[model samples]
Target: MRGNILQKSFIALQWKTSFTSQYLVAPTQVIKSMNVGNIRFIADAKNSGSKLEATVFQDDHHRDGRWWNISTEWKVACSFVVAVTSFFLNARYERIQVQKEIKLNRIQSQIKDLYGPLYGNRLVSDTSYRAVMKSHKGLKKYLSEARRKKDAEMIHCWRSYVWNVLYPLDKAAVDLILNNAHLIAQGEFPKEFEQLLMHAARMEFVMESWKNDDGALESAKRFDDDDYLEVSNASGLIFRTQILTHVKQKYDTLRDEQKQILLDISSDKQADDILAKIYQKVTHQDL
Candidate 1:
């Protein structure tokens, strides 16, 4: 009987130790968890020396059931977050691409309809005019030495250039501005551009009057060789020729602002984050 008692005590101690070890390891997660009813059932017959009967786990089922529900809720929430992020990110990407296309189109229009023609015509006119000045000194000595055949020939060449070449090119530039004034960079027309139109108009009247007078040097005498040399390089014509330098600056600046060229572009983890960046990059800030 004493050996039997010793064996029962050892067995009870071992069972308690095992339960404690499982509780310590993962009390809430264990399938063999003990609840208050089982603890009481163990206590009621602690020393009665009866067979211990118990369920492996609690009957409540709330704790583990709630955990499974929480896990499933978290899964659904994460899926929703991913969906929302994808939707907005795609929208932001399209918006940025559209904005880029709009800007590129406007730059194209400015280059094609306005600055391109203006710059090209000015380049040709200025190049030819400068070549004449460099080659023949541009009707300067011709005025004093008009009695000589070579000087007369030089004056005739210069005069023909002023009428045929210079006037036509200036008129073409003026017409371009008139047709596309809406495309100017500023709110109002530039004074330089306006002066070009005025110069073209003034020279047109002079040419018409000279031709009407049968070309007896009528416009030349009245306008005077000295005035011709001075006013030919007037403020309007200055702006016209200076455009060879100015247009290039504006053109290249716009080109560098292009969507594909600027460095330091990056991707974002979220939609709104990158949307703000693109707005600042494409619209507000300089590229």
Candidate 2:
């Protein structure tokens, strides 16, 4: 550095000496030309490669260059950290989204296909049974004394109302419960729901006993005690306790979960979009 600076200084001195000797007659013009030439020489020397060294010695661009390297490195590290963090966060976010969607789908199946129909069946069963029981002498008395004595009123009510109305409703409820056991929250389901199926099964045999007897009068017209089918396991279900209350509670809970999951999914989408923008700006890449 010292050698280079000294060489330029010597050249400047030669120019000054030449200006003094050669331009003595025309000092002003020669001095102007010499000054310009000397300045150009110094500039050329500085441009030759001394600029970087000079800048370093003067504590200028060297620090800037170092600081730029540091800045770029910092940005790279920041990008790396952000990339790693985003990778894990996005993975976990997708996992949670998958879980929420799975649960939401399950609830949808329950409400739309299973419990929804079962609940409607419950309403029909409860309303029809209560209405019929209200008008008649009640199911127990009608089946026991009235049915045994072959009472006209009981037989007419069975043929007209019970056989036509309640039978179909009960069959639907049983079929729903039987088919959709997978959606049950308690896995095995409440005994009441089981018992309802048992009741329906027995009632099916009782109603269809006419067909079993080849259309005979006693078997076709009446529910004979002799033709009672003993359903296995004695599973019992009460529509009110098992279906009405349980299904409502389950349906409401699932609906709430579904609503919350929808909100979470919306928020997660927003978060993912924001993260994608940040990642693009940081790493200069698309999601």
What is candidate 2's lDDT per residue for 124-184, written digit by digit as tens?
A: 7777777776755555544565545655455544545656677788788888877888888
Among the numbered candidates, top lDDT falls to: 2
- Candidate 1: clashing residue pairs, number: 0
lDDT of 1: 0.59
Q: Give the TM-score of each candidate.
A: 0.58, 0.65
Over 4 Å off, model 1: 1-64, 136-155, 212-237, 259-287
Predicted candidate 1 versus true structure: per-residue lDDT over 1-287, tens digit per residue: 43564356446655774675533321222123345333222322323333343333333444467787899999999989999998998899778767766777777788789887887887898788777676555444444444343234444545566777888898888889889888776557776676677778877765554352565433333443443342332222345455667666666666576544222133323555777789788775554
**lDDT of model number 2:** 0.61
Backbone clash numbers for all candidates listed: 0, 7
Q: What's the CA error at residue 193 for candidate 1, in Å?
A: 1.3
Clashes of 2: 7
